[model samples]
Target: MSRATATATGFIAVLLWALLALFTVGSSPTPPLLLNTLCFGIGGIVGLIWAWATGSVPQMRTVPLRVYAFGALGLFAYHLLYFSALRLAPAAEAGLIAYLWPLLIVVFSGLLPSETLKAGHVIGAILGFSGAALIISGGGAGLSTEYLPGYLLALLAAFTWAGYSVLSRLVGSAPTASVAVFCIATSLLSFPLHLMFEETVFPTTALGWASIAGLGLGPVGFAFYVWDIGCKHGDIQLLGTSSYAAPLLSTLVLILAGIAAPSMTLLWATLLITGGAGVAARASFSSN
Candidate 1:
């Protein structure tokens, strides 16, 4: 794909991801483990079918086991921590904290053999982190010792995803097939987790089922494939910086869904995060 097409695909994938927070908003009758199992199982099947139809099925067996393992573990850990954190803390705060992955990506990208660390990247990361902090505080949930575990889990989720993205860059494989492997691995792994720790509670409402379907078909499934393509073929620095917009877009999704209200604090958060990302992107280009 051309750079422009890859970039557009990346943005579209990010937009799909923005809907994730909304889809996972309310407490569900379904347990997190079971929900993950079902959602990703469906996604895996879909991806497998797509791979088959596109003549990519043969490539699935070609992916390195290490790549499969890392992709699966990373996604599973992220969602596990994220879902648990949502239950333990307020969604807004948890979401903002988890969204720190983008900044972490910029920071960690410097460790790559082909990438260089830069002062502007560090400064931008600081600004972005500050903005995320502001959003968390703006939620008006004062420092309660009660939610400390949740906070830590969300931070870990951010770290885990950042590591996953960085590591994925090193994998030379068919992107769609890799995503299929990821989904299938996550689905299989979640089964034992659900049986061990959770009681299965299937969705009983239309909205609940819809959320599951949306998640399976969009964010959890195709988005991963698109993201892989973008990471491999697109403008890495620009995509890294633009990803800061995901949380802001997620917040807007929540507001539109009536799960959250508009606040001036969010406006300020947007400005800071966007400015920081822009600064980082400029620095990356100059360094290159």
Candidate 2:
């Protein structure tokens, strides 16, 4: 890709993911019971559109019980934690805090024989955690004791996501596009979970549906599509740095729209979290 094209695509990535997060903030409290499921429900439809746009899409297998099971499990837990966090805390809080998963994965990576932490990785992890602490504190004791549970829940989101990211690597040999199949499988699974857990399966409005579609398509659907392309064609360094830009963008959009009030404090946290992720990615990149 030309420099111009890469730059343009990068902008799209920044905008799409950030915008999706803002939507999550705005739509969560008012939305359908299974907010996350609704998002992915919309996402599955968008995934198909993207597939058709590219060319003929691959048909997913119905016999792969293991793949479907894993898919379902990942989506189910991620949504549960994600929506719960949104309800429990501010949108900016939940979004920025969730980025901590990069550091969590790095710390855990040291346990695996395949990954070894370097001096820089350790330093980055510490800095990242400290940065998050600062943001939570925010100038003069912005940390409400009430906010603790939401923070912990966001951390759980990070942990669940980190585990999923690592588990995903084990299956990296599969076709990149096949992840879409996994997502559809996730949707199939999510409906049942929503049925059991939510006690209802309904959204409030077209806007809520739109929000769900945005998540389904962008974060879960189109985001993956772009990511598959990125892995094939993007610079690892660019991907590392740019991945962190999402939360900042999301927070900014929310604040501007009067849905969330954020600060440059988010920038500090973004640095630590994204920096840690970059370190981990580089560490993994070097081992290969």
lDDT of 1: 0.77
Tens-place lDDT digits, model 2, residues 170-273:
54334445566667666676666667766663457787657776777776667765665565566645664566666656667877888865556666666666
Each prediction's TM-score versus the true structure: 0.89, 0.80
Per-residue CA lDDT of candidate 1, range 17-104, in tens? 8888777764366777887787799889888888888898777787778878888898898888887777676665667778878777
Whole-model lDDT per candidate: 0.77, 0.65
Q: Candidate 1: give the clashing pairs.
A: none
Q: Model 2 segments beyond 4 Å from truth?
A: 1-11, 30-33, 52-65, 105-111, 135-143, 199-206, 263-267, 275-288
Task: State the TM-score for model 2.
Answer: 0.80
RMSD of candidate 2 to true structure, Å = 3.6
